[model samples]
Target: MEKVINETDDKIKQYNVCVSYFDTLQECSFSCCFPVNVKPPVIVSADILKFPRTEYICGENFALDGIEAKVCFSDNEFLLYNYGENEGLFSSDVTTLNKTGNNEVEIKIRNKYNNDGFKYILTVIVKENRLVSIDIGKNNEGDVYFRLGKQYTDKVFFDHFSVTKHFEYNKGMTHDIKNNVVFNFEKLQYLGNGSFTGVLYARYTENEKTYYGEYVCDASGNNRIILLTPLPVSLTTEKAESVNISNLAQKLKSANITYKVRYQDNTELTFTGDVFNNNTYSCNGVTYTINCNKNSIWLDWKADKMDCKETSLEAGKLYIEDFWYYGEEDLIKSVDFKNEKTLIFESENIIPEDLSSYFSATVEYITGCKITINGNQLNKSIDKENKLITVSYNGLKFQHSFSYSYSSNGD
Candidate 1:
């Protein structure tokens, strides 16, 4: 009987039998039983690698994700490091890799039945670290952001070259490249909140052959690129403030209100306001005033303003143009002239004295003369005399010693 069972088992194995049923075969014709064949599990090919091998720093985050295979890494074999589950994907944050020599990233995977499928071996080529220029936040937590701002200073860099690269990292994660240059400025403590509102300035000195960069800020709480034209060029804010022209209601049309533009390098553009649609705007190719139902924000002229002969600007585009002005016929209580040709006008805001608010008029004759306002203290003597004017500011007394000249010169 034992010999018969052995013969049956052999026959079953040879025929690739699916089941063993001894009752189906007679003792004389009995054969062996065999199990069905099982196939080997499938293995997925996964890898780990660095992006740009040559960079300035090493401690910076090295991020990893979107891995479709089970993976693990270790400095030693006794302690096994598992990264993904059976038939799962994995990733990693910034971690130290082998600085020199060959570093390997090992991986193992299992199939549906949890059977070992295959193990993969990967190599990471770690290169020596180098020092390059960085202009954004520190690389501690690995995440950072930056924005354009207005800042004028001499400390940030060389006299001619400036840095403008903004970067952020966290757990070694990288951006989608499109938004790489843009970063949030609030989180970086080294780059103060105020600096984000300043411009990213750079200067490259030909003599020194060095590049320097800094952030510049405007007085009106905005950070803009120092020389680079802002992206999207212009932005229109909903009018939230009322523009009251009733004060100059009398001098509306007959005498053009002087328009003054303050530009880079202390350059100024002066023109007169032209009234249209109950709003007054300067005539220079760069500025205009718009009156909306609710609010009004300054809209800059587009880049094509010089080529296009239209005073009307696009509805919601951003451009840098003139906004402020001074007129030739506007009443002046005081006027003073300096060697550089300074002429001060007299105007006061409607604020109480205790409020620490003082107003003075500035007369700008585009590329001509800029009058730096000293003070606007009520000149009772000038008001009484109707011609003589006197003003005081910070212990400096200035009197009006000039007359109003309105020669349009065919203007």
Candidate 2:
């Protein structure tokens, strides 16, 4: 028998044994030495060979490929590589899952002999990107309606859907989805005059995967065409007796006045012209007011008809019967002295103690009489060649003419 073994390094290794015996008489040999203990491989378990799929959606494009890890090693067990196709050994600090809900993803592995590293958390949920909700109704001949589903729940239906015009999605006009609503839907060509926004795009299937939501719909339809019957909050003209304060606007344009209206379905329209010519008239949006009366003039025109006596015609009075005036300078209609009627002052102590701030005026009162510039004086410098500045009003008076002169190269 003979045995010998040696060749191993990591510390301790030696083995030699020889034992020989040849039949009965001469021939003997015996040797023994033993020791073999070379360590350097002890990592019994590393985990994860297949386990990575914890729900994902929001912008999903994640990749940790088949996710593999095994490792073992006390004497071999390998299976790494697939951190999404070779990440040296295997690694991941998240490679695209785009945050939505819980999303951890650590996953690492390395032991290229002894670098030793292994971790694995990987939570990943990420959902968001669902948007299917739109519902706005109104139908009883009043049109406008839409519907879609799922968000706060309305039961949800739709194996396929499509609607457009939130901005014309891509080219405009689309529509599909029948029982799930979408009736009438006017607003003409959409864009807003009051409502209607659109854009649905849905699809279905829940746990079998195949979603596609996206709904908007705001300002739901109705550009005004819902009158099943209702338009008469008030309308009823016709009344104009005697009117003639000097032909009150040609007798209210020959007085045609009619109006009528009445609708809740009993239907009856009528709106004659010159409806009192502007004593106020509007119809659908209600305005009316023209029950005229005026007639009885005579401010003065005595041909001796008992010295003139008719009077009742004053609602915005203007009954002139031969008048004449040229007095208070015709009530003065122009006088705008907003400063400078002649002012030259090179600092006479910076003159202007408040001569009404250099005499102001601006009066333009005619028939609405309001004449101003009440009194502003500073005319007391009689010796330095009269430097007046008076202003007064009502009994009218004006004068500004200043002069100070005191230059020292501050020109």
The prediction achieving the highest lDDT against the true structure is 2
Per-residue lDDT tens digits for candidate 2, residues 57-144, read 6666666667766777666655555566656776678667777989888876766554566777878778765533332322233332
Which structure among the candidates has the greatest TM-score?
2
Tell me which residue pairs clash in candidate 2. 196-219, 196-221
RMSD of 1: 21.5
Q: Write down the TM-score of every candidate.
A: 0.22, 0.24
Off by over 4 Å in 1: 1-102, 115-117, 127-131, 136-211, 217-411
Task: Write the residue-wise lDDT of candidate 1 on 1-411 in tens digits.
Answer: 222223212122323453333554564444565545433223343333322232323344333332343222221112122333321533232366635545555444333333433455545555444322234221122111222222323332222223333233222322221111222122122333122222342333333344343443434534332222111233311111233332332233223444344432234544444443355443322334442221222333432121112244322323222223322222223344322222223332221232112325344432234456534332312332333233433233433332222224411
Q: Distance from true position, residue 367, model 2, in Å?
A: 15
Residue-level error in angstroms, candidate 1, position 218? 8.0
lDDT of 1: 0.32
